[model samples]
Target: MKINKLLILAALPMIGLTANAQDKGPQKNDFTVAATVSYNNTVMQNAAVGTLPSYNGFQAQSTNWNDKSLQVGIEGGWFFLDEWKLVLGGGMSITKHPGYSGVPGSADSDESFEWGDVPSYGAVADQNFVQFNVYTGVDRYFKTKVDGLYLYAGARVGYAYGRNISFTDDEYNMGKSVGEAFNVRGALTGGVEYYITDGLFVGAQVDPFAYTYNRSLIKPQEGLSNLDANSHNYSILAAPTIKIGFKF
Candidate 1:
């Protein structure tokens, strides 16, 4: 079921690529399908867990929070009504930050594991998300040329779906309150996009914040007092992109 949903999101861009070509008309009504490439450094983002326990009996804390990460994706759109375009697209992203060394065994939690799988396995005590975006929004253009660059801005909303979060046995018992997954997540996103050309764009977007709803989450863990003490959040992000596209 999860794989199918992901496939649907990943294949959305093709709808625009198959549209019939519009002759001259307003040109804005033309559709576009461009392969895009983008890279961004997540220099800073802050999260706060509820509060940490004075006891050192358990292994707890969110993974490295300030580490840098990278994202690359492809996006395309269909302009059905000249000025209004429905953008349905998706891409993949990876985090550069490696997680804690291993799932140290303990009396309360007996889970054990190797350290190398931290990032890829996502099976340890770490907080990270991996997913893509398929958004739809209205774009209004005001400029001089059909293919030339134009400045524009608009609202976008989409559904975010992924298994992006998981847990290892060693990560159990450390929940702010109780019954929190190694990671828990759901998708929600909104942001803006700009056109450098009818087929190219530069955009910045963010997913809605994730909520653990655990009391302990409201309470800080050792390394992540900022999380519960403040808030531990992960998001589905698609941004700081320089993607070139084309109309079919």
Candidate 2:
């Protein structure tokens, strides 16, 4: 009888442990890593207005676009708290612009000039840009009705360095540094994710506001020498991204 009672006591503890494990539910995942690709058609734009001494009372306006910028990056996060995560990421971007042609002349005048008019003179006639950025942020995830669906809000601070080079010909080696900039920015981010499987998911995110300070360095050109290398310029911008991730 005593041996049977001892066996009962041992089995009772095992049963209690199983019941406790069931009541606690499945373990939550605490870490995630992701890769993202983003595109921005109008990352930057600028317009300039001026008057030329040769054209009496004439005003000229010029516009520029930094179109079709592409970025690829990776991000990783640790959920230190139940619903809060610490995130870090880094990326590189490339932007290209169409080649520039000299301003068209009036139909009445036969005098027209190309950008390569002067010997040994070069203009950033066609530009290509490359940039790198790194950031750290905090994210909060919310519970949702559907299993494997997640939503998050985050904020990040980052620094970026970029350069734009102009090439004289199709060979990119014949190029000169036309412009460069260093920037620091802070952003507010929000996103949604849906996990197709327990460990993999797809998502999209947007930065509604990014406050930035930019310091620019640009080469001098004919008739336009007003660029300041030590100026403090501020801008507000937004960025959107699509990503795929894995959680473990």
Candidate 3:
């Protein structure tokens, strides 16, 4: 009977310690607000068509690198259940392409074709792209040995608005237009964060896959007709992001 009593006493302290740990665990009511930046370097292929001879009846592909764009955004989330959160975010991005210029019939004519009979004829073409996106997602956190370290996995859906402007210096004035588009995409993500204090943290995240549906309107150039196009794209490998945030 004495040994049984000692065993019971030992178990009581362990039970108390477990209860104390639970009482000190992270709260479900915590709210977090964060800022994020991301870069993607993968090249994407885009299709183009137009009523002009240069564009008519020809199947052509344009290539652009996703990493050439820069993104900045803000996100906010509330933990409604232990280790589970619902988040909403918005961001903007800018992308650019630099084109080459060369003179025709001169020593500088190596890169560009001569237009008409002008000996000094030269051409330079470039594009600027802009985009804005809004998204929402749910994440579940996994606890780590470090008190403030967190790891999570989530899925997100977003709507985006985009525009592209192409500029060219040529006698025929080709490759100038304002193209606008809208798209929706879904992504799967994983992230890790480290809290610098009880209320401040820094993190990083990556999206492995993102599928998009897009619709675009290409404005008429000079005398050309307006072109409307729809496309579906899959980003098998998306972007990785850096994030910082505060919790309350």
Best of the candidates, lDDT: 3
- Candidate 2 overall lDDT versus native: 0.59
Best by TM-score: 3
Question: How many collisions per candidate?
Answer: 20, 0, 1
lDDT of 3 by residue, 9-127 (tens): 99999998766644432359999998888752222222221223354442211112262476566789999988999999776778898865646564345455455534654465577
Candidate 1 segments whose C-alpha is farther than 4 A from its true place: 1-29, 38-68, 91-132, 145-147, 164-238
Write one digit per residue (lDDT tens) for candidate 1, span 1-248: 99999998887766444332212222555776655444322121212222334534333233222232455555667777765666666544444333353433333322444454342222234445443335455555444354343444454544332222322233433432221213222333344444543344554444344232111222233344422222244544433345455555
lDDT of 1 at 93: 47
Residue range with the least summed lDDT across 10 consecutive positions in model 1: 41-50
- Please say which candidate is ahead in TM-score: 2 or 3: 3
Compute each candidate's TM-score over C-alphas: 0.38, 0.52, 0.58
Q: Order the candidates by lDDT, highest first.
A: 3, 2, 1
**Tens digits of per-residue lDDT for model 2 on 129-193?**
78776789998887677666778898988776766665444232233335556656677888888
Model 3, CA-based lDDT: 0.68
Q: For candidate 3, list the clashing residue pairs, or say none.
A: 40-67
